[model samples]
Target: MRYKRSTQERSLTSPARTTAPHVKKNVDRYGTTKLGKAAEKGDLEAVKQAYEQSPDELNQPDYAGIAPLQKASLKGHAGVVAYLIKQGCRPDVQDDQGDTPLIDAVTNGELDVVRILLKHGVNPHHSNSNGQRAMDFLE
Candidate 1:
């Protein structure tokens, strides 16, 4: 036999028992369009200002799926790249497709950029889902 009616089903209906859906912080939406584009244009001051104004600048990505560091490296902007590194932007942070800044440097045949990325802790062995690593992207 069942345990009979205990405290009734009302306990399960308590208003406080309801759960709310999780919502991400709105800050995540703020990508450094200014900073990333500045990196592309080799605008060091703009890149610096963008980073200073938005600490989350590291998370910003361009339309090409390139993060700030990736954009800087792609443009071969050593100054902007160095400044981003100082602000804690990682070179190996892959985009949606897992294309890291190192991959961009390698593919572009930017030797200095690749060396800088490697020095900043980008793993050369890391691969995307397509099985392409920074090494694969190398010229």
Candidate 2:
């Protein structure tokens, strides 16, 4: 069966942007901040600029609670993921769906990303909200 996109996924794919007068403004409308989008797109220079401006952006999650590292990992951006991890982004942080970067890597068949995450000590046995472990998705 085909699963529908989660709220987070929907946000990730959307491109609409809006700002409220009394609320904080987001960097983008895709459930991500500027840094998150940069990482997802594998724009190393943008990621570097964002990081240089705010070191905390490396660990900060977007509106959907998906961190820059997770976005990079999900998109198979090994360089971005490695850079974020080096900046102290935790690889095991779970999104709203409880999927870690390692789980995302495994789900997307990102062998290189999976290896990078593993080398950084991301837990291999951790399960997602669906109770599926990273290894369960392996070929």
Candidate 3:
């Protein structure tokens, strides 16, 4: 399902000069913010920079409700996942499909990311919208 941002919704890619603060912004048309892109690429430094610019963006979801943490988890970026968790990103946050970071990591066979998420206390038994739990994906 594609989500269309309303006119009032800001884009994270918007120029930094914009004065509006506190308004949650959507990612670009691709459903990824600078932070999300950085996380997806396993660029920890870029993630840090993007996060520092907008702390709130840490938990902000893309059009599909996928947060940067989930993106990192999907790509098996253990360092990025750890850093995001340290930055207060919710480990159990669900995407539009109700898949959490733990689920993403497990589904993608990202064992290291899975370990980090488990160590952080994410719920392994948590189920997605389809009733599939993280443990269900375990080998």
Lowest lDDT sum, 10 consecutive residues, model 2, at 15-24
lDDT per residue (tens digit) for residues 43-129 in model 3: 999999999987878887776678899999999999999999999999889987899999999999999998999999998888888
RMSD of each: 10.7, 9.0, 7.0
Candidate 1 regions exceeding 4 Å error are: 1-32
After superposition, candidate 3 runs with Cα above 4 Å error: 1-26
Question: Per-residue lDDT for 13-110 in model 1, tens only?
Answer: 23332212211111233333666767778898887786676566565553335677887787788777888887888767777688787877888887
lDDT of 3 at 77: 98
Worst window of 10 by summed lDDT in candidate 1: 18-27
Q: What would the per-residue lDDT of candidate 2 be over residues 1-139, giving only the tens digit for each residue?
A: 9987534312334334222321224456544667887899999999999888767566667667788999998999999988888888888998878899999999899889999999999999998889989999988
TM-score of each: 0.71, 0.79, 0.82
Q: After superposition, how far is residue 85 of candidate 2 from its true place, in Å?
A: 0.6
The candidate that wins on TM-score is 3
Candidate No. with top lDDT:
3
In model 1, how large is the Cα lDDT of residue 1? 69
